[model samples]
Target: MIQMPLQDMIKKITDGAGISEQEVNDKIKQKLEQLSGLISKEGAAHIISNELGVKLIPETTGRLEIKNILMGMRDVEVVGKVTHNFGIREFKTDNREGKVANIIIADETGSIRIVCWGDQADKTSDLNPGDIVKISSGYVRSNQERNEIHMNDRSVLEKNPEGITIDIGPSAASRKKIEELAENEGNAELLGTIVQVFDPKFFEVCPECNKRAKPTESGAYSCPQHGDVTPNYSYLLTAYLDDGTGNIQAVFFRNLVESLLGKNAEEILSYKDNPSAIEQIKTDLLGNMIKVTGRVNKNTMFERLEFVVQSVDPNPNPDDELKLLEKEKQSVEAQAVTEEVQ
Candidate 1:
């Protein structure tokens, strides 16, 4: 039921297939008339694009701002700087193999993750942090509570195209109180005190596939992808964060947890059986003011909003914050004095 604009669909068809705009328009009109209300205009455009071997960019031109992207939108275009690029990783299934890469792209409005699949993943190999790129014919989908743009075979990747200039800079993450957090608001930054640190635990993962390993009756762990194999350890940390307005549960994965704890998974795993060591670690994290950045999503398991922490800053400077608070307090007192004088 997703619909793209008619003009965008036409442009995609012509540009992708190297056909004239008139030719694509004629074919689209023919398809619409032949279908005779059986399909919508966007649907007919898709059909025409498929028949002509044109990769239709979803419903938008590449000029749409990052903040305006939404779920279920097709052929969305965006231009932004690459803030973080996780190099390509390969995977295999029973029948085939493929590669995928993920990079965080940011504009002045905000940031979103771009997932490039198959050969398109290779196309992004030369991209580095601070490189401005344009994504064309990409599709939008909501992963958890994050808006993600995915590039398929038909998607276009343009690096620093002429005549287009984006002022490259760090994407600003909006500061939100715990109570103000909403699902699918893109990326967010929150400042809160860690009210509680749940017990940290390590989960066994498949060495080959990196998915959680399943325990078998034979006292060995099995991975669905690679069968029986020696498992690797991955950390999962859960905690509650509270600002004055409200409290929310936050989850951190291996890398973020390592950064916050100042230790790697192996070092923490060494103390797994030592209850006192684990308790000491948890105690250290409690009552600390930290800033966390990540996507907010509905945790189906808990049936509530949960934050998936991507990055954490344990020691952000508070001088500016204190000055701002002082300025606000002084303004309030000045207003009260003015009222008394009146």
Candidate 2:
């Protein structure tokens, strides 16, 4: 039996497979150590990644698969167009006394914060808010609040000269057939990366029907469709979402606004600098799997289909569904009591 160092075993495993070195050294240390006892010293020295079936990827690494990227991974390169730039922040490192720049980048898959060091930050300057980028050799890292990617010395990025490509994965937009969506009664799974969120403005429209709001003489707005009604100005986000099947504009109604910001739609739309609000809205919708229940509105001018959302539930979070069930139960019980009284 040959003797092998644990470090060597980690290297061998990560090198053969697309797994990250951090996975063998940090996350799977205990598992590797335990497996070490079972194998001969020589065998342990050459732990194969294929033995694990799947690679241990880092968090926030952009990849070909948006779902996998959102969930976190070892390393991945994703291509996306920057929908908005929220500026960059500088943070100082205690040990090195050096600063790093942090910026958020979004693809049709989702949005993740990228940390740039030294020349990388400067190189990214040419990449503006709407330009496309191919982030290469990126690794995922999770913080206390969320998962993000580090674009430090180890990472590399390239601009996409061919324009932003529209290929998400199998679970992404291509699967949502418009014909099927029209026939389905309940929620339809929709895939898209949100590109924009329009800020709300003062307008009058029918409360029931969201037609173009009209202005009247009393320094107020009125909806002509609904006669003699008070004007309501609500913050509703208008997002450009690309689902590969086609790029369409969508209105994420009210609940999605509350779920994302812990605030109502009215609050989100009223902000003066709407770019920040747009960023938050994008984070909540992009890359995240969603089941959008709404009717399709065909845009004659844009030749695109829009989902005027009735309800949106993040597929990754099951608690929202559970809450809906609980509410339904309470409603049914209350209705039963009312019927008995009648």
Best by TM-score: 1
Supply candidate 1's per-residue lDDT for 10.
87
Error of 1 at 242 (Å): 0.8
Q: TM-score, each model?
A: 0.48, 0.33
How do the residues 286-335 of candidate 1 rate in per-residue lDDT, one tens digit apiece? 89989899878767577898988988998767996578568878998999
Clashing pairs in 2: 57-73, 57-74, 58-73, 58-74, 59-140, 109-287, 204-213
Error of 1 at 92 (Å): 30
Please report the candidate that would top lDDT against the real structure.
Answer: 1
Model 2 bad stretches (over 4 Å): 1-63, 70-75, 167-342
How would you encode candidate 2's per-residue C-alpha lDDT over 1-342 as one tens digit per residue?
Answer: 122345655665677565787665554555457886676433433444436653333333335644345323445676666543434445566666454555555655555666667767776666675567777777666654456666767678777657466442232232254434431112345545555555643344567777656777776666676765665555455666665555556666556656534566556655634556555655655565455556465454776566776666545356764685588789989999999997
As for candidate 1, its clashing pairs are 4-59, 57-75, 58-74, 58-75, 59-74
lDDT of 2: 0.56
